[model samples]
Target: MKFLHSADWQLGKPFGRFDPDVRGALTEARFDAIDALGRAAAEHGAQHVIVAGDIFDTEGPEDRTIVQAISRMDRHACSWWLLPGNHDFARNGGLWDRVRQRAGDKIAILSEPEPRELEEQIWLLPAPLIHRHNLEDPTTLFEAMETPGARLRIGIAHGSIRDFGSSGETKNQIAPDRARLSNLDYLALGDWHGTLKVDARTWYSGTPETDRFQRDEPGGALVVEVHPDIAPTVTPIRTGRFQWLNRDWTVNDKAAFDAECDELLAKVDAPNTLLQLSLAGITSLGDRVAMLARLENDLGHRLRHLAVRPDDLVGRPREEDLAALSVEGMLGTAATKLNAKIDAGGPDGVIAKRALERLFVEYSREEQA
Candidate 1:
């Protein structure tokens, strides 16, 4: 049987870290991913689709979000199973009731740990979370759960796997080898926001849409093929609309810095991307000011969001930089003092360097005006 495995839809999550426009686009992308999931299910010829857990961002999402989710799932027109995750656990029965009312008989919600026979050959044992947090392993029952003869047993669960998602002290843990002990053909997991494989039989289908730049795993679903005798094979498919990037660069010279910025700008084909840029290395005060001006005027507004972390970006006023500033008398003397302080290298040096950079920026802006 061919099936699609996915999880962590996390609908109605507010992307508050980004600007208003970017936030709206990100939130919409979550919904957009649902549409894409249905299309993918049809395109990949998946007979069934299973969402491991965390169907909603919160237990009590807006009613409209629930309605829209049901509406999107209706398009798939295949056997769809949703296991309640920590984010939308069965603690809130009313939310699931609303979902069931809207979903009708199309989508089945797995709210308990029980074996569900999808067909004569396929059986699913789902461990649905009823609380946001738990001290014991949710999938422990899978070890003792029995399936009918000549059936492909699959375990569906949501939580942190052993040796993952914590520093050896995580709650809601799943045994790393749950699939082997359960004697199952495959184990589909959720909770980790990245596609991960634990042993050959256990796998995590990360969030379909890319929300943060840190998760290096490609955002998508897993297409799994299972037969009566052979081990199930899984393939990751991309389903995200926007790309999340984290670029860290060290600019030691002006020409290299300009080229880097130009290259980054040239790659902006879409307006729904998120970029977190961290810049370091030493450069002249004048060049730093010019770079900031270019970013503020030329590149900032064009992208969905741009965050520049400049804590390690040092501003060294070179002799040529000081000459370009064209200050005289007391101002020139103060600039020299600041430069010496920067050369000394201490907390005061950082303050002095920032003050000099501001002076240069103000003067340059005034000249431009």
Candidate 2:
């Protein structure tokens, strides 16, 4: 049996940290991931798409979110199996109930632990979450869960495997060796937001689209092919529209800095890239101003989002930096005072250094004008 494995759709995620427009774009991208997944299913010849868990970001999602998800799932020819995870656990007359009412016959909400037969000899053992956190392993019953004597059994579940997602706490933990214990051909998992392999037959499918900045890179879906008495084949297929990237660079001079900047810009698809760039090492204040200006004017305008940290990219004020301020005017006077305060070293020095850098940036902008 060949299927597309995905999870953590988080349909109504607000993304409050970003500006309203950026937040809307990111939110829409999550939906776009669904369309991408549908195409991928057709392309990969997947008969089913099993999302391990966390289909919604919260238990109480808007009707619009539920409607939108179901509508998209209906577009694909393949059947979609959605399981409730920690974020949206199964509750009586809750989110799952509403989804069921509107969802087409093709969509199945695996809100129970019943064994569902996808085909004549293919079985899906879903250990859907009933509570937000279950002390006992949800898949524990798989050992005794009955199926025909010679059939392919697949287990789908959510939660961490031995403290996989907490601060040394095993909340909703799954046994590391559950697949072997359950006599399953494949075990599909969720909660971890990056695709991962846990043993030969078990895997965490991760989120189809990434939401956080620090998650494992290259978020996408997985394609799995399995049969009884044979090892399952799992392949990752990218279905995300945006790229969340983090980069660190060390700078000592303008040439090296410019080279690095050019290289980075050349590598990324700017409109789809959200970059968080941090810099370290010492460079002259003049070059620092240039670096920041280029980052703001060039990269910032092109990239979907840009966050820069220049704190450790310390600026040592040079003669030309001071010379540009005109050594005899109010600009020069303010620069001298701020520079002196920086030398004195205190909370005031930090403020002075920031002010001086701003002065350089403003002056450079005006000079260009």
Best by TM-score: 1
Give a tens-digit lDDT track for model 1, residues 196-247.
8887788988889977777544469899988766788899998887777888
* lDDT agreement of model 1 with the native: 0.81
TM-score of each: 0.94, 0.92
Question: What local lDDT does model 2 show for residue 263?
Answer: 93
lDDT of 2: 0.86
lDDT, residue 204, candidate 1: 88
Q: Write the per-residue lDDT of candidate 2 for residues 1-369, one digit (tens) a residue.
A: 799999989889999888887898998888888888889999999989999989999999998888888888889899999999988999999989999889888899999898888888788999988888898999998887778864799999998886654431126889989999999999999888888799989998877788877653556998999977889988988888778888899998788889988897798787888888898877888888778879999988998888999898878778888887975489988999998998999999989988988888788788889
- Computed on alpha carbons, the lDDT of every model, listed in order, comes to 0.81, 0.86
